[model samples]
Target: MNCQPWLKTLVYKCINIEHSCLLCSELAEQHYPLCVACEHELPWLDEHCLRCALPLPMAGLICAQCSRRPPAFDQVIAPWHYGFPLDTLISRFKHNGQWPLGRLMAEMLGLQLHHRYLDDLARPDLLLPVPLARRRLRERGFNQAGMLGRWLSKALAIECDEQLLLRTRETPAQQSLNAQARQRNLRRAFALASAASLKGSHVAVVDDVLTTGATAQAVAQLLREAGARRVDVYCLARTAKPGQA
Candidate 1:
């Protein structure tokens, strides 16, 4: 007879006593789920915009576009670029419900953030996940950003408050819109709960990816309006603007 479901699960667990790097399948001997080689070779971010973390030719400098009209968030800390295998992994995790991939991504992000925090970066007083509207939440069954935030909050010992930010109205997906359209779509879409106040606080808004920075900008504006002293966008990956190199 075939093995029972529980027996199969037990066998799977027995086989996975040693964790392997998700990318190269090498045995991961250390913490955070990836082997040293694979971790180093992953699509790490570098030479990005100081403000939005958009991939660029130079590091520690803001881009010309941002110089003209700066975004509301003060800083962005992202470890990876949205490309290749990393993109595939994130898509599987976010859309296909492959939770293990998400956990691995979250752990990697936490490791980067920990390093930055130790190196004198200003750590946010709170971690707030970019909220999903009710309709999208229903369709997806879970918010990827919220899950990422939970992992990061625990790793850094920071307070995470996902309930404070509310998505008041559902709008078209940001990916389908141009920069102007995206801004217009998100206008007045986010609000703070009555009991929540960002007065004199610094917050990091957590998300899975920062593409055009539209969503982050919108949320940061809301936080600033509510009296938050500063806002940072914390994401796992930061994509180059639609046509930029």
Candidate 2:
């Protein structure tokens, strides 16, 4: 046996490692930079639409609206509701470039998916980060979705392809538009880089938040047109449908 490994373990045990909570700076119990109390206080989605991850009154069922008009994506797996410190964290991470918070979110999301995978669900063959427009990318200095995808890809050992998906054109910000207008804004906004060999590949589009889900739906339709067998959406947080402005 290697004595080197034993020496390293001895040194590790000799050092007292302390993790502080991101929110309260209390001694954290979880590995994701958050204390048990803070983690429990987050707006966790207990019941949601299986298809969209929209907050619902009960669990383990699809919502009526989805049954009436199904979306292009087959399923969504979001770990939290888009509210409170999570929304604030995302905002700063996306706009102000607070990478630490974004990374923490990514770590937590990876843990959630890893635990959920015990069910032996159909895993995606490829992970694609929802593309940001060129203008937004230049302004923001980074694509937040892409960062999350990189983290998840490494964590789950899934292949992630950032170059294959293309945002062909820029559109109005989805947050500024209502559901119908949001759908219209994204029409013809995406295209595949190459339809080389993904005829029956299952792909999951990674994103930070699922708002109206117009973006995911549009991307799913685009992926289908590119011959993907199935497309799912994986988001860190999900927002409730906003009333039309």
For candidate 1, the lDDT comes to 0.89
- Which ranges in model 1 have alpha carbons more than 4 Å from their true place? 1-17
Query: Which candidate should be chosen as best, given lDDT against the real structure?
Result: 1
Predicted candidate 2 versus true structure: per-residue lDDT over 1-245, tens digit per residue: 67999999889656635678878998885556788889888889878998888988789888877899999999999999888978998999999999988888888888888888887657889999999999999999999999999989998899988998899998978887888899899999998886446789999999999988899999999888778899989999988866511
Alpha-carbon TM-score of each model against the true structure: 0.90, 0.91
For all candidates, what are the clash counts? Answer: 0, 0
TM-score, structure 1 vs. true = 0.90
Off by over 4 Å in 2: 1-17, 243-245
